[model samples]
Target: MKIKVLGCSAGIGDSRRTSCCLLDADILLDVGTGAGELSLEGLIGINHVFLTHAHLDHAGLLPLVADAAGRFRDRPVIVHALAETVAALRECMFNWRLWPDYAALPSLERPFLRYEAVEVGATLSLGGRKITPLPARHAVPAVGYWIDSGQASLALSGDTTLCEEFWDALSRIENLKYLLIETAFLNADAALAAVAGHMTADLLAAGLSRLRRPVEVYVTHLEPGWEDRIMAEIGAACAGFDVRRLRQGMEFEF
Candidate 1:
């Protein structure tokens, strides 16, 4: 499987886009402004979307995806997410007030999009790929994902703080090669990070200490202007680990 990073910032800016990534062209990890980079044909090629949560920066552009390519396709774009995430999108984004009810538009039986609730630890196999949802500790109900291609695997910890369950799951993936985790704040903001359910450099160091296995780690969700400062802190704090900043347009094949 080849996973491409579209956007991975905590906030948006002229050059920075929020959390989103494309998995082997057909699956979207999160549909943020980064998805706007795709052309019409590129958008049409997407078949499935696995959301980490319902935050706008993570899932804001999903409506446009359905509107842009839904009519050209024979089937609805399948959205797999937690029941809470599905409910949040339904009540907020796709309820016809904010955006068209694509799930119910054109007719119920032939809608442009569909929702499938996913649970933690439940693995879903599609084609030759296997995807499993992992536990996430956040302000809202959220989840991370473990993508296994049989040869190797990649685990993405979608916006989370210090969660032992997430670390426990990562330790069990024998084939895990890459870990894309979020470190949204700096050590100075440790208190805020705790309240927001995001990770600080200190918190990240604590979480990494729990994982006994070594994997290539890329830290994501850094706020735009403060990236350098936060990373400097992260470098000092997590010097013992292999951690790098996740850049956009980067691709990982496993």
Candidate 2:
């Protein structure tokens, strides 16, 4: 399996793209602004989207992608997300007022998009890979994903704070190679990080201290302007682990 970092910034700015990842070539981790970087052919080839939450940065491009793809093909793009997140998308994003309802476009039976409500802790298989939705702590309903493809597995923390279940679930998986966790703020923003259900350098370090096994940890979703400071702080805090900051266009093959 190959995981490509489309964007890993906390907010959009020059040289910063929102959080999004591509699994192999068919699956998307989140359809954030980074998705806009994909070519028209790449966009049409995407078959499934596993959304982390309903936040605009995490799911902002759904409507546009669906609309563009719908016009070029007859296939439906499956959006797999938590029920609440799915509901929120319909109510806030895909509503006719905000954007045309792709779920009802073309025809009800042959719509351009399909929403699949995934349950936390459940694993679904597709295209020879297993996608497990792990519960995540966020302002909105969210989940981390453990994607297993025969010989290798990768875990993504999505956007979350310290949580026992996330660690416990990861421990149960064998041969886990990489952990794509979030570090949305610097240590100075610890208070804001906590209230926003995001992790800071200090908190992420303390949280990872409990892990029983070590994995290659690549932190993502950092505030663009503080990337260097945040990376240095996280490095100091997680000195014992193989931790690094995720950069756009970086690729991981497992």
Candidate 3:
């Protein structure tokens, strides 16, 4: 599978964009602002979107995607998310007031968007790819994804704080090859990080210590301006494993 980082910043500024990753060509990991980086052709090619949470940074571009690609596609865009997250999107985001309700637009019988509620442990097979929703602790209902291309597996920890359930779920993956986790703040902002349901470099280092197996780890969602500091702190604290910063447009084949 080809995994591409559409955006990996904690917040948007300058060239930085919020979380969004494209798996191969048809599947979107999260439809964040980073999704804007894609061309209209690329957006039209996305058949499925797996959202990690209801946060704007993670799901901001959903409405835009539907609006832009609805007329071009023959079918509705399948959006897979937790039931609570789906509810939040319907109530807060696509409720006509905030944005057009694409799920019911054109016609209820043939809307441009479709929603599928998935449980934490539910595994979905799309073609030959296997996608499993993993547990996450965030401000709102959230989940990460475990994607297996049958050859190798990649684990993504969507926006989260320190949660043992996440680690427990990740430890059981047998063919785990790449782990894309988030460290949104520097250690100096540890208190704020905890309150915002994000991890600091120190927190990430401690979390990494709980892992039973060594895997290629990539740090993501670093807040703008503090990327260098957070990465330096991560390097200093997490000396046991090789952890690199995730960059936009970076691709991984596994």
lDDT of each candidate versus the true structure: 0.92, 0.87, 0.91
Number of backbone collisions per candidate, in order? 0, 0, 0
lDDT of 2 by residue, 1-254 (tens): 88899988889988789988998888899999999988888888889999999998989988887876777777899999999999999999888899888899888989999999999888999978889999788877789999888787899999998777888888888878889999988888877887798888888887687767778899999877888998899888888889987889999888
* Per-prediction TM-score to the true structure, in the order listed: 0.98, 0.97, 0.98
Kindly report which residue pairs in candidate 2 clash with one another. Answer: none
Model 1 compared with the native: what TM-score? 0.98
Error of 3 at 182 (Å): 0.5
Worst 10 residues of 3 by lDDT: 205-214
RMSD of 2: 1.0
How well does candidate 1 match the true structure, expressed as C-alpha RMSD?
0.7
Question: How much is 216 displaced in model 2, in angstroms?
Answer: 0.3
